[model samples]
Target chain A: MKAVAVLPGKPNSVHLREIPQPKLNDQPHAHVCSIPEGRAVLVKTLQIGVDATDREINEALYGNAPPGGEHLVIGHESFGEVLEVGAKVTELKPGDLVSCTVRRPGGSIYDKIGRNDITSEETYYERGINLCHGYMTEMFVDDAEYMVKVPPQLRHLGVLSEPASVCAKAIDQAYLAQHRLQVWSPKRAFVLGAGQIGLLATMMLKLRGLDVYTLATKPGPHRKSEIATAYGATYVSTKQESMHDLAKRVGKP
Target chain B: MKAVAVLPGKPNSVHLREIPQPKLNDQPHAHVCSIPEGRAVLVKTLQIGVDATDREINEALYGNAPPGGEHLVIGHESFGEVLEVGAKVTELKPGDLVSCTVRRPGGSIYDKIGRNDITSEETYYERGINLCHGYMTEMFVDDAEYMVKVPPQLRHLGVLSEPASVCAKAIDQAYLAQHRLQVWSPKRAFVLGAGQIGLLATMMLKLRGLDVYTLATKPGPHRKSEIATAYGATYVSTKQESMHDLAKRVGKP
Candidate 1:
């Protein structure tokens, strides 16, 4: 199978390579295999999103290949098509749109309860990011638990699930942290960047009925700013005015 | 009235000072005065626990005098006898044992919900620590909302209530953060430090049925270690072994 591979932490090491096609077979690594046979789903790749994480991994900033392997297959944000499912798999079927969760659980108490994203271990595992192969290839097999079905109508935006989950998880945690507040009703928000994640977060916050402010470096009447304003968010460029001044002018968000 | 006061941020400034006695009357500061008169409680100080916060304040580490005042009355942990109750007071009465909550509400959303302890504002209001006079005086009057009735049987240990609440709130927050875990039943805990707060936390965790390991710098057979063991928690002296080595010996806690 053709896949993008990188020698993690080695600058400019990204290259095309032939790798073994993933299969739903019994393997020592439970994370690498679909257990009990019936809960495994084979996904065929349709779209994979490349972001800063992939760039940084290629730049030797941080990332790792799976143990005993020479190269890491890179891609964590992906939308795919379900090509096959084991006899016992009931949640998904061939031709279904889907996306895979990146973080595989470690031995942390948090990991034991399906929150592998907040693992407490000294090391972490993220497919294609560290200690696991990500879905940057033609096909991959994983436990049904890791695959999330994307509605066929929203297939075009399915590749966004991984990135959108990042924003969603952050908002979820904020609300979780505010559980102490008992009845928190935030009216405004300040998102400090105007990147993809920031824009997506602004959209999500807007959906929740918050007045949003998206801030970026350049004084922009540009495409990014337009998208933010389209979501009814005020786009502020830090270059034109400092955050401190803005906060004082508009009050804390 | 004689109260222990400090010139905040001035080293070794703690001293006995004559201050105006508190009365249940209208004042410019709502926190300083019990408003509407009917819900106020006049508390006569019985015992005050001076902890690290006081010591640090005396050392000028961090603390502030109330606005327009040169000295800050310093005592946030105290047990008191209710000397009088407002006309409309329902929760507490004269002769009742009680303790006052430390953090006072600010303008933040958290503060508005009786969670002033977790206020998000840049400045915080804790009686005796920041902008408010504390309980190190003969008597003080406050709203009944701030006074927690201590059981008569626990009178001897009432002063511990403020400190105990600190531990209870922390544990509460831990449980709250674990809401995502759904059914998290932690079996073990590792509490670093063997200070007053640490021991209190260990005791609280023990009460919750967790096997706790309380770590300290000193070697065992000391007063703190004995106290820890008395509560059925294992005491570890980090000087004897590194945390990494300890984790390997006992598994993650």
Candidate 2:
């Protein structure tokens, strides 16, 4: 199988390389093939989203290859299909659409309870990011624990599940933080950037009944600002007017 | 009556000053006496705890006097006895032990919902610390909404309530933050400072079944160290060993 990979610590070293097809127990590394194991899943890649993290990794800003391996696979936002499932895998079956979680568990107690995403350990692992193989290849095998089944009707949008999860988690955190208040009915929300994540967050907050304000450095009536305004969000150009002045005009978020 | 006051923005200007006795509706300013209002209470000052906030205010670091006033009354941590209650004040009555909440409501929506402590507005009001007068005087009047009833038996420790509330709120925030984890059973707790708040937090965490480490600059066997050790927490002298070495020696916290 040919897969996109980058030599860790080498800038612009992204290239396709041949690797052995994955097997059920060949979970961590494809070349280290082993006999099939129950509850393991073999997935055929469908779509992978290239994000800022991937660009930085390719730029050699930060990324670690798997131990004893020279190259790191660089796609973390992924959607795939279940080509095969171990006998003990009851939740997902062959032909099921799926998206795998990015971060893999580390040795922290947080990892022991399914909260590996918030692991306290200094050294952590994330698929396709730090010391782990990501889902940028033709196929990969992982424990069923990391795969989230996506419905067939939503297959086209499944590629967005990873990024959407990031937005969802951020919204969850906002509500959790504001839980300190006796009653918090925020009528307005201010999102500071106009990137993909920011736009997604603006839509989410708008859906939640907040009057949204999306601020960006770029002056606009451009597509991004158009999308924001289409969703009833006020888009402000920080380059044209300072955030302080904008806030003074729009009121508190 | 004599009360401690500071000329706002004037360093070392703390001095005793005479102010008129407080009456119901004499809320925002001591001299602006008005007719009593419903839900108001007159509290006779019992004890006031002076902390770092007072020192900073005295040093002209930050503080505000009421509008059209020159001197700011400098005390926030206070315990008092209810000397009188407004006609419509139902929860509290004369002779009840009480402590006043520090921050009062501002214009932001957060303040409107009784969460003034986290008001989003750039301008805020806090009793004794900002535009409002504090409880350092012989007596003061406030809405019953701001007065928390302290049981008669706990009167001796009432002054500690303000500081204890600060620690309590911090722990609540920590739990709120860690709620992202599926399960977070932090086995070890590390407290960076051994100040009054730090010691209080150390004791609280110790009581909550965590193995706590209280780190301070001074060498151990002192009173603060003794208090920490008495609470079943290990006291580490950071001067003796760097935090990096200490963490490596003990374990993750």
What docking tier does model 2 reach? acceptable
What is the C-alpha lDDT profile of model 1 across B126-227, one tens digit per residue? 888988889999998777888889999998889988888988998988888777544567889999998878999999999999999999999999999999
Superposing all C-alpha atoms, what RMSD in Å does each candidate have to the true structure?
A: 4.2, 4.1
**For residues B1-253, what per-residue lDDT tens digits would candidate 2 score against the true structure?**
8899999999999999999887676656434222246878889999999999999999999998988989999899999999989889999989999999988766677776667777787876788998888899999888887789999989888998899899878887787666656566778889999988889899899988999999999998999999999999999999998899988898755
> Candidate 1 docking: what grade?
acceptable
Error of 2 at B102 (Å): 2.9
Q: Note the residue pairs that clash in candidate 1.
A: A128-A134
Q: What does the lDDT come to for candidate 1? A: 0.86
Q: How big a share of the true inter-chain contacts is recovered in candidate 2? A: 0.52
Q: What is the TM-score of model 2 when looking only at chain B?
A: 0.93
The lDDT for every candidate, in the order shown, is: 0.86, 0.86
Clashes of 1: 1
How close is candidate 1 at the interface, in terms of C-alpha RMSD after superposing the true interface residues?
3.2
Superposed by TM-score, candidate 1 places the C-alpha of residue A1 at a distance from the truth, in angstroms, of 4.3
